[model samples]
Target: MSSLRAYRQIVRRPSRKIYVGPVAVGGDAPISVQTMTNTLTTDVDGTLDQIRRSAAAGADIVRVSCPDEDSTKALKDIVAGSPVPIVADIHFHYRRAIEAAEAGAACLRINPGNIGSEDRVREVIKAAKDYGCSMRIGVNAGSLERDLLEQYGEPCPDAMVESARRHMRILEDNDFTNFKISVKASDVFLAVAAYQALADACDYPLHLGITEAGGLRGGTVKSSVGLGMLLWSGIGDTIRVSLSADPVEEVRVGYEILKSLDLRHRGVRVVSCPSCARQGFDVVKTVATLEERLAHIEEPISLSVIGCIVNGPGEARETDVGLTGGGGGSHMVYLAGNQDHKIGTEAMVDHLVALVEKKAAVLAAERAAARAAADEPK
Candidate 1:
């Protein structure tokens, strides 16, 4: 079945794999979802609180900015408490990169070309090697190298790719291969073009994002359209959906993008139809309520909530649990694509929540049993 599923898959581009702590990126690994913390890094407790929330929301990696010595000083505690690996965002400061690596950061976000002299870059590489930390060469259009800006005359895709290559060359010169690269721009076209060019130019893992992509609504749409193109083409190894909203929302949106592509799965995915006048029950409110209630489920399962029987039965046949609204204030409930029972409007949301929770427990137990049997002696 898995092979049959792969037969219809989008063939991903081949790229070298690198590890950020225990999490792997590229080389056929599941595409990772990441989000940056907005809390001041020096506030260890506050930062850890946000990291915990993002991790709970399915962030594979969490980045915390290290703009000063104080932030680096607090990194040790944050790293110790964080459930997921931490990436220290360091720019223009070679010393902070070294400090962050020593403080147990899994990766350092830096551009070797912008962090002072060649000697400084080499020192940072040495620190990364010594402390078993990876690096991310982040090139942004808003902060292109002066020479590149002058040469290209603007923040174009060519300029962004050149900037990435320049930083990449510095890492290559130092023999540092444990790194990934991202070329981002606020403009969707520029960012997409830069990533496409970079993916063609190198075998290194490409991190995808459209930086500073507005607030919640705008950012989600922009990121979906841009990153969706890259992902469908098998370009991104990891992704960050940048937004001005809560960092957890970024994680959620990132997973949603991946889920839409069937690339990665976590939690309960609700397939709901836009409510219409043909509905039998309040489909909109039911979906909204069910989404919140099912957020705690980590197992990958599908639930379809349809307004009426027009497409409900077909969709229900493909999901683990489903609800299709019916006339006279009653609805149908499906278990494993088979009609198991009928539920009333008054008990709809609560009943679905109970059914899903029960289903999740069964799936989790089966997974655990399989793992246990696999570990038993032959």
Candidate 2:
């Protein structure tokens, strides 16, 4: 009922905008979510399958590794069939970078210096420009340039930023600016510090990540902490939660972080409580089930699944759909923030799923109508 305060807002950093296929990054664009495919690049069908699933999970961009000649050749089909833009990941292979560009990659994740020789760098850059592809200067703390490692004696924020600058200089020297940059480290502190320094040092869009972040659960927490701190400061332009899980989970986690920050919203935003002694239903299992069932609904909606009356009514007031557990093996359901009806536990999940589906359908029609209205001659 009240407007958000200034402190609740994220005033994003001003940086030059660039396009990865159709998605824009930086300079007033909605911060994008990216995930990398674990499938081998040469496995075209397998790679496309993963890309399709990741895109459905809300990945704005997907990167696939291109380690050799075979991978780049397979990239053409992968790019052609991909629903979202493809970023070809090239490390120490300028030829693969060029081939990826020629294969219709939307972006090349390549470091110019490591690709060997100024001429090779120029050729890769030429291919990128000629093929209408963008570039990403990816600097990972685990793989900082040898000279920088020697100079700094370790991987730290300074060394990371210096590596980014060195690569950034290569593109800048060639008068190329259609690119974004990332300085990632497995160490949260190092990654955050490096991103902070780089954010101040240049106006290039930053791709945030804690590289080599562990498995799903642990990696999610680690990335959330590091990325949350950076996003809270309005520093990152795009993010990838580098989890050692399905790339779809990475996209999901990326969106969750953005949703928590109020920077972006897609699909259901669940507000559930950890079960306690007074809970009326199985809160843990219910929330998990609801999340799995509602994953396909991309329309932004919020639902509150609380087990008892203590905080149930309060949370239900803020969400679109609310299920509050009550006695008599039945539960209370709230629609549009008002107490609406009751149903038995046997019918609860299905009933709530129907309510959300109906709500999402209505929301979709309203959006379509709004778009039609906007398109009409004024």
Q: Top model by TM-score, which number?
A: 2
The sequence of per-residue lDDT tens digits that candidate 1 reaches over residues 1-378 is 599687658889999999999999999899999999999888889999999999999999999999999999999999999999999999888999999999999999998887899989989999999999999999999999898889999999999998888888889988999999999999999999999999999999989999999999999999999999999888999999999999999999999999988999888989999989989998888888998888888899999999999999999999999999999998999989998899999988889999889989998999999999999999
RMSD in angstroms between candidate 1 and the native structure over all alpha carbons: 1.7
Determine which window of 10 residues in candidate 2 has minimal summed lDDT: 1-10
lDDT assessment of candidate 2: 0.93
Q: 370, model 2: CA deviation in Å?
A: 1.8
Q: Give the alpha carbon lDDT tens digit for every residue of 132-234 in model 2.
A: 9999999998888899999999999999898889888998899899999999999999999999999999999999999989999999999999999999999
* Model 2 residue pairs with clashes: none
Off by over 4 Å in 2: 1-4
* TM-scores of all candidate predictions against the true structure: 0.97, 0.98
Candidate 1 TM-score to native: 0.97
